[model samples]
Target chain A: MIEVEGLTKFYGAFPAIQELSFNARPGEIVGFLGPNGAGKTTTMRILAGYMPPTSGTARVAGFDVVDQSLEVRRRVGYLPETVPLYPEMSVFEYLTFMGSLRRVPELEDRVDEVLEQVAMLERSESYIGNLSKGLRQRVGLAQALLHKPEVLILDEPTIGLDPAQIIEVRRIIQELGRERTVLLSTHILPEAQQICGRVLIINRGKIVAEDSPGNLQAQLAGAERLVVAAGASCEQLLQLLGGLPGISSVRAGSRDGEVEVATVPGKDLRPLLARTIVEAGVDLMELRTSGLSLEEIFLQLTREENDEQAGG
Target chain B: MRNVWIIASREFRQYFISPIAYALATMLYLILGGIFFINVYFGLETGQITPDGRIVIGAMVTILLFATPAITMRLLADEYRMGTMELLLTAPVRDWELVVGKWLGAFGFMSVVLAVTWVYPLILHRMTSPGIDQGTLVAAYVGLLLMVAAMLAIGVFISALFRSPVAAFFVSLGVMLALWIVGSLASSSGTMGQLAGYLSFVDHYYNNFYLGVLDLGDAVYFLSLTALALFLGAQVVEARRWR
Candidate 1:
């Protein structure tokens, strides 16, 4: 439902997002994972029709963001990083006002529907300034959902919330993803891993990697490590495991009766190692594969991009 | 047009819900009422009836010079400071809709101030024989409304330029004062002086409506100035997207 092609944006001489291209299909949650100042917000702003890209094109629901901004805006619901709201307005009043601005067909009914969806019906009469941060964020979400747009672009939706509130928002986003296209941006790696169906890792105005969280982790799980508890001395086991095919190195682990093994990239030495241990009459107590976490994968991707930029 | 009215009504409701609108209204009525009472008291003492409310109209023009900025300073500045401009600009509404809506909202408040001041003329009519010249009274009010509309437009434009309401308020006051005093600084004779006089807001008011003479030139002058200010304010709002 959203397509961005060679989208570059420059503020004065500095490029915020350069030659970035990505797409999010309907009923999919695409997490834009990036560190702070990694052009996440800039990319989302361009898609939301808040600003035109310096070059290239961004289309939402088949409408070009720059050429048909109003139509694009009508089809996309954006929650900015700041969750902008009028503090003086009541929750119901704010949503009604936003609904009217979005030209929603049944503004009052739509306001109530969104309010219920955000679980904020009880606090509809309360002033926005008097609400807690979590409640205000929900109100922000209600306003974004007021018109029931086809695409939802959220910038750091879970930022500045307590852990419980974060989980609640994640649940809402996961639920929302089942109905429409959601392009959520966040610096939090776990947020992407836990919720997004696909992840786009961006760094320094460029997308470094894009894949599912599991796929990203698996792709970066090169030189996989293994831990084994055996009925042999660490040195002897190391010697035996090191001699096996695909086993690059073996060393004594921190605990007694344990040996650590490292295999070459794309190599699975578990079955071979098990058979060798059994034929040698060595007891195998335990064997486990330790793959890279999404956090480590994210760090590696961004760090490698930074290093490549620095080297070039 | 519907979007414009939506934004306009929201801004208008905001003015009444906040204490600032009431405070401004109180200050305006006090100044206008105080000047009207003093003029009547002095007229009674001299045993001469001056039923022409032109002096009150003149004071109102000066009062609006200060009061309008207070009303308009928060139009766009508060939106920026509070971060609501993102919500506003990203909506399906056009830039001109937001600008014109806010300008009309502030103008609506100024209209209330003008409406309240009418009581002074009503009282003058009740107290004086051969009361007020209906034509002069109507003409004076038309002039005041036009001046207020022009000043509010200028205030809205200045407000759009700054993120801080205080800065917007002071800058608007400074600009209005400069425009008000430009005619006094002119020599009143040379071609350059004539240009300066024509540019001055004070000259337009005094030469036309303040003297109970309705001049179409002054009317067009204020309307065109208001339109120019509003157009510039809309441009500023649109430029923010590029920034």
Candidate 2:
């Protein structure tokens, strides 16, 4: 568990994270969502005891981060954005060194265990510099897990990986969430949606929104979208859908020999529209009704935050 | 202490694998060899390279000035450049353990370099029929070793202050040169000056050990200086982590 109160960080005159406060309970995977320069890295560094907070305080497992840093460091495993590693060292050597730094009992055995867990046991002898980006990340994860700390703070853990590698890292992270506290920061919106139980959206060094994915979607409820494809011209489709009951607005696009129609808010007009389109002798290719995906929700949150700041 | 040993061993292992360790060692011994052979073969006419305490002492201290920075500069700079400092600083190991371990590792490297240079004296022995007096040779080697140990510590201390290897090298070299010069100048000035001269690494080697005397005061001076450097290195690292 962790507690943070009015945490602020200033790099000279510039504020990195300002008056930020949040708590993470045990066994929860909280996603830190933000755009670049949003202070996610700064916040994580403060929690990891790597950087001092400008004002306020953060506590990990009941110990003040600044006052009881050694204890806090012992309790948290931090993976920085760049995945710091010694190029000259083999994977096994790096993990062993990390284990000893944590003063882990049976360090060799612990190193093997983490290597196996990360699916890196076979590549233990490979020099870190020679490893591909994915394997290098795996090694970084292995080092963080070697100490078996209570909390894991990973910053952009899956950045720069291919799609498959991203999925692998995400699986490992989701597994890690079951038993340990996880605070993952990423700019990738869908990544947060898949693994995080709760989301904290930040912009301009401040927390703008915090909620579950479903709750966030529900907050913007009644914003239903309809994507339709018909044989009619785009303008004609837009005109017809635009005047329908319960429809807010309509836009027109075309692809694959069909006019693509976008209808705002209110739907189930699909059944009525199908009959009308058939009677009107217009071909219907596809019709679907859906709310915003998580990506849209994220952009909306950040855009709203930006708008509020600009308006003020 | 166990943690210190762990850190120290890892550092030593890294030095062995890296090119810097061999490069420094090779350069040191070659320079020492050149100075030793040149003084004996060429300086004999002018009595400049006589095997007296002064000539041997000068060679030892000069070798140290050339060699100490190579071992010490990379100690902290490489860690910063490689980003491994985060891994070390965030670990549970205390700041003192990290500092002392790294200092000892660089010191151990200096010892190995000195050990290799021993072959030079052996070569000199084989060349001469009766060979140089063993007692004076032993004293000269001891003085060189102690001076290097103290200078290596100073290098480690200065390295902790900067994340740049070039900067660390220049800063450490500047400090060592200033100290050595101060020690020599003090003796000619007055009584107080003479006392300062006694603290000079050059004076300690030339006046004491080079003369075939293993003075306890000289030995203690080097040991105390090593301790002071390592302590300051530890303090600098700790303060930086806090900031």
Candidate 3:
């Protein structure tokens, strides 16, 4: 439903995004994973028809974003990073105005439906200015979804919300993605993993890696570590964990009270690990699997990129 | 065109969202009512029966020259400052729709402001035996409407340059003041005098509509100014889409 080709955008001499090519089919949840200033916003804005890319083409719902911008805008729902809004308007009023601007039929009904979808039906009469940040963000999503567009381009959809709100927003996004082509950007690697079917990891205005989260995780870091914290001494905990089946390696140097236990992929060792610790009379404080952080993945990817450039 | 009306209605509602519209209209009523009462009282005392509108028009020219800038200063500047411009620009609406819609919205509000002062003429007509000439009254309101529309266009165009509405207001006020004084300031300066007279909005109003003459050239001047400013404002809006 969305396609971008050689989408290079330059702000004077600085290239914000360079030679980018990607597409999202209907019902696909594609995550744009990148850090700040990685051209995530630039790409999303171009796709949203906010601004034209300097030297590229983008199409939303088969309409060219540059030439058929209005059509693309009609078919694409865009949620900007800051959630631009008029402070004086009530949530219902704001959504109604946006619905009219989008030329949505049954505007009031559609507005109410979207408000309900974002779980903001009761606050619909409240002024947006008086709403909390999380509520305002929900209203922003409501406005974007007002027209029931075929494609949704959301930039950092869960950036500034509490954990519960983030989970709710993520659930809504995941549900929406089941029916529409959804492209969302995020700096949180775990967020991408949770919501995205596939992710395009962008760095320095380029796509460094693009694959499913599982594939990317396996390629980048095959082994997973379970950070086990206990009241017992590190030596005793490490000894207890060292004899566990399927444990590839065990170490205790990162912190005094924690022992890092490496295990094979595609296995949930948490239950086993927890049971053994309690049976051994070792007080288990915390036990959870730790995924590779974004920084670690970027470091390895860039090093490989540098090696490839040197080889060439 | 539908998009234009949609954008315009939104802008119109925005005026009432703040207290600015009511404030401006109330001030206009007080000032115009004071002038109308004084003029009528003197006429009744001196037994001059014929109703006059010249003094009211004179005062209005200066009042609108200042008042219009305030009404139009937030046309685009506030949207930029509040980030609402991003929403407008990203929607399916055209650039011209956004610009022209802003002008029409302000024009619509100014019309209400002008309408609120209609009681002055109504009172004058009641006080005078023959009453104010209906032709002159029609011409005066039409003139005010055109003049306000033109001024709003100029203000909207200038407002596109700044994100701060206060800055837009001051600059628009400066431009209007310059246009008002240009005719007299250059009266003795030869060719420049002739050019300034052509550019002077006060001269256009005072010589034509103020005299109760519905001159086509005068109407065209205001229309042309409005068209030129709207065209330029649309251009500025379109430029925002560029990287």
Return the top candidate by TM-score.
1
Tens digit of per-residue lDDT, candidate 2, span A1-312: 879999998887888989999999888999999999999998998898887798998998788998999999999999988899989989988888888778889998888898888888999999999999889998998888888889999999999888988998899999999989999999998889889999998888999888886777756654656677887777667666666666666665435434333344444667876776777778887887656777887788789989998999
Candidate 2 wrongly placed segments (more than 4 Å): A228-285, A307-312, B35-57, B119-143, B188-199, B212-220
lDDT for model 2: 0.81
lDDT of 3 at A296: 76
Misplaced by over 4 Å in model 3 are A222-295, A298-312, B45-50
Q: Rank the candidates by TM-score, best first.
A: 1, 3, 2
Please give the RMSD of candidate 3 to the true structure. 4.5
lDDT of 2 at A261: 39
Span of ten consecutive residues with least summed lDDT in model 1 chain B: B53-62
Q: After superposition, how far is residue B9 of candidate 1 from its true place, in Å?
A: 0.9
In order of appearance, the predictions have TM-scores of: 0.95, 0.87, 0.87
Lowest-scoring 10 consecutive residues by lDDT in candidate 2 chain A? A256-265
Task: Determine the backbone clash count of candidate 3.
Answer: 0
lDDT of each: 0.89, 0.81, 0.86
Model 1 misplacement above 4 A: A229-233, A252-258, A264-286
Candidate 3 chain A: 10-residue stretch with minimal lDDT: A293-302
All candidates' chain B TM-scores are 0.95, 0.86, 0.93
Would you list the clashing residue pairs of candidate 2?
B186-B193
Residues B153-194 of candidate 3 have per-residue lDDT tens digits of: 999998987899999999999988988899785567778888
Candidate 1 local lDDT, A1-312, one digit each (tens): 999999999999999999999999999999999889999999999999898899989899999999999999998899999999888899989998998888789888788888888888889999999999899899988888888889999999998889988998999999999989999999888889999999999999999999999998878886788999898888778877778888878889888779888888887888998999888899998999888898898888889988998999
